[model samples]
Target: MSRDDKGTISVRLVNEALLAFTSAALPAEQLLHQLGLVSVDLTDTDARIDVADFSKLWRRLARHFDDEFFGMNARRMRAGSFAFVCRAAMAQQTLDGALRVALDFFGLTFEGFRGELSRSESLAEITLSETSNVPPLRAFSYFTFWMLLHGLACWLVGRRIPLLAVELRCDEPDYTDDYRVMFSRNLRFARPTTRIIFAAEVLDLPVRRSEQELHSFLAHAPSNILVKYRDTTSLASRIKAQLREVPAEQWPTSEALAQTLCVSGSTLRRRLADAGQTYQAIKDQVRQEMATLWLADASITYAEIAERLGFADVSSFYKAFRKWSGTNPGQYRSLILRADEPIASRFP
Candidate 1:
């Protein structure tokens, strides 16, 4: 996907996430530099970080501190804690039971703070509270915990669980739009507590994932956890998912896609416009994401990639890729293939 796509994280968030490293006097600069970030990238207040690199930063921090909680709690949540929790939770019969297992594990891993699960007739909630003199948790801590819990829950149930609402105890941050995109749009800040509410019926959803499925999921690690489970029920997301199922060469026109979705062409256009999207933009995004993924495979040639992505020719693919990423395909491929090389050698 393009760097400006939904798969990117705001620099404000990147800075906030690095606070733990900064406070601990660790080598945040070295880590970011190794991950292809520079002084200008971090100094630019308006810049963003690619989601893939951000995920890599997360894994690096966990390894460096031996604390997956990012030093937010007095207790160190050891590196393998999440993996262990996932394995244990997998044996549960339902999402409600699975979440209880996860909450219990985290409760045992950390100190002072606790997570509680409750349900009304129609809604279920996960609430967090601190019981001791532990330092006050930041908004990032709460949101990160939610991402883990919610992401695991969705994986266990084999689908995205739409959050009905989210209540945060801290004041709103500048990255609220990112939160809206990641979790729910109906967010409330400075509330009495921090909790996520969802449909109570989701509690009974059977654990549909197998051990093999989970092994594959864990292989991608904390990075996939960040971007894979965002709300996919939007009209745009639904369309994108549908298009991804078929080859790009077979992708339908806007009118045909509208007919397939059981709406008139005008209604389809109007709804997508209302959602701040266009048919052509969605198509471009699909091609962009596919092109990037394909570029990572050494066996795929440029001519073959262009044909697979439905470009008329190699030159046309080059032009479209440059438009999407601001760099030509060859340069992008060099950067991707040499990601482990020195920073100076990897860029430009």
Candidate 2:
């Protein structure tokens, strides 16, 4: 991990970790100490943590439960329990078939949970249901299952699955905005059941991975699933991609980005709202990412970087950078470039 890996993660990341420990009652101070995330403001919805530290926090919380499902308000899934299911999935010929195997395995293994698939001519749905035997699913647990299944489906098909929407039975949480980073913006809460929707056409896609790839994929396990999608269909992803395609004179305005997608400003704003972002928020994310890479080049002046990111002037860019990283570009540059690079990764 580089300095880039040092989050300023969404505070929801910590709250999600709490999902894995929902059944336990650990002292908050002791829990933070174990995770080395004492600096984290647990109550601050706007807070962020170093990515490396967040991973540590996750490991600490998960270990306490000794259950991979993280006590998801249902059953405690034993660590390494998913491997057998993956092995069964690899024996199938198609994604649909693999999913059937996974569904069967989960149904047999988990007492209060179920994995189901329902399809029509143009749409497909994978629903996760909870019976009365176990506690209700937490929002974090539901999100994890969605990510895990979605990630595996993509990896198995050697392509991304652009989800149309995600349905959650739980009420919206304090970290509603963070959901944008996880899934497509068309999220619906208070749904009858939890499910992910996509095109039915992908049902027949052949499984592309082999046992060797499966081994590597399993090494990361559930953590590997929590990744941002680069789908060409995703609004945020498309916005980021378009921001890179245009001239660097200044970043695109809300109207410009909306025009690129062949949508009205109101429509664009409505879509982004579902993903928990504003146009300016998307611009900030894109600009900060590009700016960080540009700033790493000491040969380039800050003014030049500002121009490249579409800032009217260097001052505005500097102010935006502070909001993104909590420090000025100069300070961030020093932390990132590291005059003498070390051999070790910032992550454990």
Model 2 C-alpha RMSD vs. true structure (Å) is 18.1
| Residue-level error in angstroms, candidate 1, position 99 | 0.4
lDDT of 1 by residue, 196-253 (tens): 7666778898987778988888877666766777733368877877898999989999
| Candidate 2 TM-score to native | 0.60
In order of appearance, the predictions have TM-scores of 0.65, 0.60
Among all candidates shown, the one with the greatest lDDT? 1
Model 1 is weakest, by summed lDDT over 10 consecutive residues, at: 339-348
Least accurate 10 contiguous residues by lDDT in model 2: 339-348
Cα deviation at 301, candidate 2, in Å, is 52
lDDT of 2 by residue, 1-348 (tens): 112322245776676776444435665555676656666667776666754565566555556666656566445666565677777887888999988888887677666667788774455677776664334566777876766567677777877676655767678765655464556555666656667766667879998777898898876644455543332225776676677666656566788777878999999999998877787877676676677667656899999998888788989999987776445777656643442343221112
Every model's Cα RMSD, please? 18.9, 18.1
